[model samples]
Target chain A: MNVPLLQVRNLTHSFLEGEEKVHALRGVSFNANQGEITSIIGPSGCGKSTLMYLLGLLDQPDSGEIIINNNSISKLNEIQKTQLRNEKIGFIFQFHFLIKELSARENVALPAIKKGEDSEDALERADQILNQLGLSEKLDRFANKLSGGEQQRVAIARALINSPSLILADEPTGNLDTANSEIVFDLLQRLSREQNLAVLLVTHNNQLARRCDRFISMNDGLIVD
Target chain B: MTMSLIGIIFGISFFIVTQAQTSGFQTYFIRTILGTNGAIRISDRFQDMKGTVNKISKDGQFKFQFKSREDAEYIDGVDYPGKIRNALSEFPSINGISEVFECNAALQTKSRNYSVQAHGIRINDHMIASEIENQLMHGSIENFLSDEMGIFIGNRVAERLNLHVNDRVNIVGKKGNFQLRVSGIFETGVSEIDKKRIYISLATARSIEGKRFGGSVFQLSMFNPDNARSVASQIQQTLGHRTVSWQEREKVWLDVFKALRISSAITVSTILLLSGLGMFNVFAIMVIEKTRDVAILRSIGFEPKDISAIFLWQGMIVLIAGIVGGVLFGVIGTYLVSQIPLEIRGIFTTDSFVVNWDISHYIWAILIATIFVSIASWIPARRASKVEPAKIIRETI
Candidate 1:
């Protein structure tokens, strides 16, 4: 058996709201393998986004051990975490968070550029990714000028530019119409199967969650099933 | 950014123009002072005139001595004056030397008598070495030199005595009184010199002082007046006489000039600092406005230092543009100021304003401005780099 791409053991986190302590997660344990789409679905305030933040290395859990590619990340320094994030994980957000001033290709190329890739090569790779995502005609359009679906596709292209081993997307199609939503979910599923990438998606859409390879439902910050 | 750049331009251009103008004024003042007084002056007190003169022969070489009615002992003059002259003549820095015979006397007009300092000079040689001859107000130096008892009076002396060219005045010396004609009037622009000094011929001076006062001092002009201190020291060491350089003689004025230069530097530095603060505020506002963009950049794996560099590069570009534009504007403004026909009257009268086109001022202005801009930009850049991407993203969502 291949080693799991991600492993979280006994993760726990909480914060104080004025006079009351609110526990966001309580000793949650999870694991994800390569070439699999793990959909995390839950009701509001179920700590789904909280779990995603911890998994993405954007926050440190109060008590937990996170292992990515068999390297423990719980004790990693900020710089090491940043390096790991840059080299091993990619992220997509609900709002499409594209830099409005940049063109579609430039937006896609930003992550590769930040990773210290050559400008010419980064730009060429961005073009190839956009073309593969059926955005060849919109490569030169500014992020603000693109349609809702095109902008989401550009955001997806930016995430894929680094070619990371794991993709963590939080509501990647939450703002899209039904047709664009289907298209985006199909693209994520196909990319996971074809590229052998481990994908963890947080969503409230039951129809989309059912289509993922494995679905984990959460309630009161614990994985009930 | 535009406002910050404008501030830098104003600061730099103001510094450049003021430096040029101040330097021009200082140069003119120094040159005028040097023109009235030679670069160096060597003189002797001759306290023991009798003992000094007894050691020399009554030969043609040493011709005169300082005589007083009360002192029975007297010397003929400086023994072998030619030997001292010849010793100083060999110096390559010496441009020319003028023999100066000086005495304290009283001038009497019809109504009043006033104390005066009388200078007896070899007219042609003195004219070649000093600027007094060229500053004549009423008559020519040639005319002043032609008469046996002719005198050139300063403007203030002529005015106070109500005298003019061709008016005869009586000069009372220690030994005798001599009648002299005011052949010319000159203005040196120095109030002390113009009010009390009178120039006469060497022959007339000898007659009034009983033929015992030859040249009492030597005024030396140098090829480069700035080297006067070293040259004066050499002359003093060589001849054992007292020597004073122009810088030492006008130390008070030089001190004033130094103070003015220091104050100008302080003013320019303050202006540059204020411009830097203005730049800092502009960048700070830019960072604040782009908070979300910074968050996204951070999320995409751009290090904090890289984010800082981007903002710093923007500031540097603005600073460079400001410096270049300011230098060009300063040069043009200086040129315009130089063309204006403005006359200034102080210790001397300048016919027109002058501007010094010194390149060092330009370079120093640019260097100072750059340093200030870098400091200003770095502070805001560091703040921008510390922005938390997760917090901003969560808040915005």
Candidate 2:
């Protein structure tokens, strides 16, 4: 196949601890194809999150080449990195992290607003997305007023506001109950298929990982297929 | 937020009161001088004239004539002969006509003789000054008119001359030596005039020079002190003679105002700078505390301009709110304070000094100070726009 949508090669990352050295990621590599749901699973401290951060361009690897859409983004400047991230990537965090001051619809429309969309249009789109997530009635509710699952849904709507091509979820369902977790996982899978987006989700749940098209297990700092 | 706004309001109010006090002093000075002297003085243009101001000789006299054919005919037939006669006859009749002449006097002090200001004051003119008169410490002004050689002196002059009321003083003028009795003293709160000048009745100034109702100068008073300048000019035009308004007559107050302006500007700038620094700290802290929010905004696609605009709008809101609260409190507080008796008000007045705050100064103070604060808030707002989304998000999370 042509180059994967995202490719990581020989990614190595480490940190210093006083006199000691701690290696977080060691020359690991992974390729995630377009329009596929790829999950990365590992225990805590195995550097799974670190690898994901590097791949997401939220952190840099000491030695690695990260290619997105067949362009090696390892050399991109901060402005270019931010531009690419804003234009092509979306993130879903376990905490939701919706701004407390804004209403549910405003939280969801935030990304669209950042993209310079008209406020009314962004609000309309946010309402539409919230409705799809069964949150139409809570559009005006403040973020703090929402339930955990409702808040997570609002966050998902925010991530989708720019219609980004790739979605990165880090334990998106970590704080939810089994039922809410299943529901959120199901929604993520459905959104990937509906929007034809490439999704990479990191989770400790074997069941959630199994639902993706493919799963890569990380041990220590290396990925095992 | 309201408490913070209150703080800002208090700051603005302090500034307003300070400015009002200073401006009040200035207004008080101007009014005191204008009240003591004539609202306008039509004088001769001497080296001391400075600008359009003219100083008529102190002995200058005034007389009134009517604008009527018969009266004009009588006046020309009796008083003026030649060209003045023909002109007087040509006019139908003229009211407020005055023929002024000069009386030069050389004042003898213990050390030397110096030129002293003298005025020819008629009974009506004497009454005008008498209305504003206060204790002069020695002689009565009525004594000045009792004898052509007599003159009135103020407390300041009595102190300086080493003489008391009714004391004999010798005056050597162009007309010759005349010993005069000290007359009723008058004090108008003008230290310079009180100490340096003496007053004489129109009859005395005219008589000493062997003259009857003729002076080279005339001082004019207007219905409104505020419009004295314009009226004086109109009178000058009407009489076809030069004139000087109160402002032109007294330039010391103008210099005083200029100095006051500089000092006031310095005072205002210091207050504004303090408030601005306070606002800056507030804005900087707000920005620093909201770093994560700024990152969130940036991640969501907020341009730097948008971020700046939000803060700018917030600052503007704060400014407007503070100014409104400040002005409301300042005006009301000053009014309430002014209503109290001076003795009671002295409690707040420092060292027994009280300045009744004027409303106009209070309003202007808030406006100017708030504009300074708004400008001060811009620096932090600009710094806020430089916040990094990725760095803030990663670090904060």
Candidate 3:
């Protein structure tokens, strides 16, 4: 736990269309410690999501360095990148994009199944996580059949099924009502502390941001606070 | 993915069954023809030998010398007492006989210069002429046998010479010859025979060839159609002479059908290509549609190639199902087609029945189907592998 879970230094990302280059994030720097819920807050289109993408190893920064669990990720090949993502990081999105065809339990077990995990063991673990999220009764329900709040919870259960060291959530409660949002935020908070896992959530919800262990604010593609 | 797999099965079933039926028909056609015609024909090495001979030619066409004065007699109306009796004594179970006397005859045209065949035949033999009689466009065998100097001419010759029945035609041979009457005009269906063959009696043929007292050219027919080849071989072995079956004489037809096989493969491959494209398109669309879900999958520890493998597995299932269905349908359809009544409308000589089934067709269909479907799945599978979990997750967020 002495080493930082995610360390980003002087990261920059840009998008090119025809001849014009638009910068999405510039010199964005942060360190996320283990066993803490860290929140990144900014106005719409202020690169908070970009920062999360970079931290999640989804996109390659034009110029920067990233260290996750003491391993340099920027120099890793595609296969290595995929392995790191699969083993060490979990992501939750604003929209609960669960596969409509699979049941809640099956959806959660999908990652382990893809990783060549034993099907029966994956299923048992998926059930345990779903039960922890109070979704044991809904284990066999399809994603689309679940209510929005239940679907969000299933997504969270799926994220934790892999037991990743770092959970990167981009606006995890952005789509929920205030009550559902509070419920989701409280779950995130409890899971982060109980599991001793580092959690990075990008959101505009000030109330949820205020509850996090640390607050990082962004504006105009730069970290301001 | 399962639904698409089912569709592939349905489509391939249609293709395989139709192909099998066509293959069955082709095999049957060849076998029936070969069964009736024998597998090979061994004849005298002389290439100029044509038709049956009722009379002995003084031109020394035969290698053996005559032993009696009866071998040189000119009987105006007589069956081949020598070869027919000899062949009967040799192979008793031989059921039918046909004689073709090679002679030159002049049609009673304006110029009297047209080339004429005078293929002499016995009118009463039903079994020997059944195949040929069925091909007759006009007239009957009785019409020619009841009259003297009667003849059966091909339809084309009848048209070209403007000749009809009972027309007096002068036939002159190198030796003892006579004038004959054209009793009936027959169509052989074959263009060459229709243009040139002239049917006459064995008696007139003997006088024209001046071999009346000797023997006619030997063509042995058997009771069991399947035994034609064995009988021909036995005749060859016993007589130490050569014989020829229609199959050996008409092998060019076999060559034409052999060429058709290439076209058949090309046709099946083209269909497989279209089916593969359809499969790839479906996979590509599915991946795009489930982008966000795929992102969720990646976040949960599924690698990019694992995502691709899922679609690949789905494609393989589709192809296998389709091929199995297609083969089943093809076999059933081939059976149905074999039950169809084949109609032969004109005078021709062939075995009408064909029983065709071969293992090669099934093997080829399976091999080609698998290869085609795999190639089809390759492109879309690659595209699926390129999906970045981070991009997907970021987009959804």
Candidate 4:
């Protein structure tokens, strides 16, 4: 196989709940290759979200290694991790967590701005991406003013603004209706193929998983398939 | 945020008004004292010895006289007043100089007798000697000067003796008892000065105290009274006389002014501190409310420092707004307070509430507000920065 865009080896994570240590992830391994939309589907409490977080670098694995674009990032400091996330990885959560105070374009441009890109240029890029996602009219609208579908589209525009090699999305269409979900899933797949990007999707929608380039199933904190 | 701004406004306004009132009283008190004592005074003991010897030689042997002190005590006077004036004239700070003969004597009326301080000032330089000319409540300094036996008594002293302008009083000195008339009764609002001081002519003072009394001192007014100490030191170095500044002469009053300033500072600081605490609570709540947003930003690639900076900028914006509003309201409040005609009579008398438009105080108030707001914001910003994206995301999911 071609060198994967993102690779995770023996990822483990645990949480302490009322003095009981519950294993959220147990030595889970996964690879997401360029030009492919890889979907991870499982039932609730199956550690799919936990693995996605570890791969996204939002949470540190207890014992594992995450290599992105051929560079090991597991040993990187928090600042380096944030920089890598800014420059190389993108995230789309289920809730479309856009800052309510900012406009849709500003929300999209935030990651690029944080990466020290010129604000005007970042905003211009954000406007172009948002337009491509059919959100041109909502560019100046505040996040809270937009509908659920429009907000998720803005989140997708934000995830694509930095043009990261790997996009880690956790239930990006979870809060959307069937029409919006199909539209978003189609857009992600198209972007993955056209831009040669690795798209990792964590979801409970098996029908959507079956349409991806590759699919992995998880249960009891382990990859079952 | 509104509460914080209001607190800052009230604190700064109170501070500005208090400073203005206290400074007004101090300025009035100092001016009154300077009117009588001058900005700087050179004692007679440091007078030129050679000039005294020449006077003794020209006038023959003079009788030794002790006024208020013991018989063995000797009181010297300024023998070369012109020489001292000429020497001080070279200094740019020296505005004007006057000669004065001061002594202790008993003022006896028909009903009551009191020991009083007598200042015999040059009629030509009386305005330069003290502000007594402007302080005359009953009669003019010209009337006091034209009458050879005329004396300017304080209002309290006049009240004590039931004396009025043109009233004759017995002034008994070591040389002889002289009958003097009160030509002017002045009120400086200083208890010590109003109760005990009386001004007479230099020639009359000399006659009453005998030939032993030359000009007892050289009183000087400076262009900037605040520079009196340095100028006095310079005069001492150049003229070989012991010089005293107005501040040094009124040490007790200056101490009182210092206490007033300290108390005002404490009050203003406490107010600002409470304002800061109020801001801290508001920012803390904002941080808590914006936790999910903070996590979202972190997930979008913001570093911890960047997260902190966003919240800090928010706090700084609020602080700037509060500072601008506070300053405007403070100035307005001070102006309003000044417009109210309130006479303050304490150790001194202030005709009206005076507001000093000193720019430094306003700048200090702004600086204090900025520091307090910064501290208030930093705590919440730090806490906000430490929020974990994973924890928030998991909780929400």
| Segments of candidate 4 deviating more than 4 angstroms | A1-3, A118-121, B39-99, B104-116, B123-196, B214-245, B344-347
Question: Model 4, residue A107: displacement in angstroms?
Answer: 2.0
Summarize candidate 4's per-residue lDDT along A1-225 as a digit string, tens digits: 455888888888998878999899998888889999999999998898888788778888889888898889966888899888888888998998999999999999999988889999999999999999998888999999999989988998898888899999999989999999999999999999888889999888889999998999999999999
lDDT string for model 1 (B1-397, tens) is: 7888888998888888878877877777787777777888877533443333323456746555433323434233334456767988899998878777777788999999988898888888677568876778998876776787889998899999999999999998777888999989998877788898899887667667666645467787888998999998778656656678999888988888778777887798788889899999999999998888898887777778889999999988989898988898889888888888886556766666677899988998898899999999999999999998776776787
Best candidate (score: DockQ): 4
Alpha-carbon deviation at B338 in model 2, angstroms: 6.6
lDDT of 4 by residue, B1-397 (tens): 8888788777776776677666766777787788767899987444233333222334686645222212122236566777767887798888778888888888999887899998887766868666777788998877877788899998889989999998899998868788998889998777778888898887777777775545488888888899998888777656656678998888998999879977887888899899999989999999989999989988888988988898789878877777777777778877887787877554566666766777777777778888888999999999998998898988887
List pairs with backbone clashes in candidate 1. B64-B76, B65-B76, B65-B212
TM-score of predicted chain A against the true chain A, for each candidate: 0.96, 0.94, 0.96, 0.97
The number of clashing residue pairs in model 4 is 2
Two-chain complex of model 4, DockQ on C-alpha atoms against the true structure: 0.69
Candidates in order, TM-scores: namely 0.76, 0.62, 0.66, 0.81
Off by over 4 Å in 3: A1-3, A17-19, B1-22, B32-251, B255-277, B345-355, B392-397
Please provide, for model 3 over B1-397, each residue's C-alpha lDDT reduced to its tens digit, 9 standing for 90 to 100. Answer: 4544555454455455555555554555544443322333333322222332445468956654322222233323224445443654556556565544556665556555567765555666422623455545666666676886777777788888777777776666656556667766765444566777777787777777777554344444555544555666566445434555544455576565566665666666566666767777788788788777666666566667777787778778887787777678767766776676665423232223233466666776677777767866766777777777666665555
lDDT of every predicted structure (CA atoms) = 0.83, 0.68, 0.69, 0.83
Preferred candidate (DockQ higher): 1 or 4: 4
Expressed as tens digits, the lDDT of each residue in A94-159 for candidate 3 is: 887788999999988877776678999999999999999999899999999998899999889888
Model 4 per-residue lDDT at A200: 94
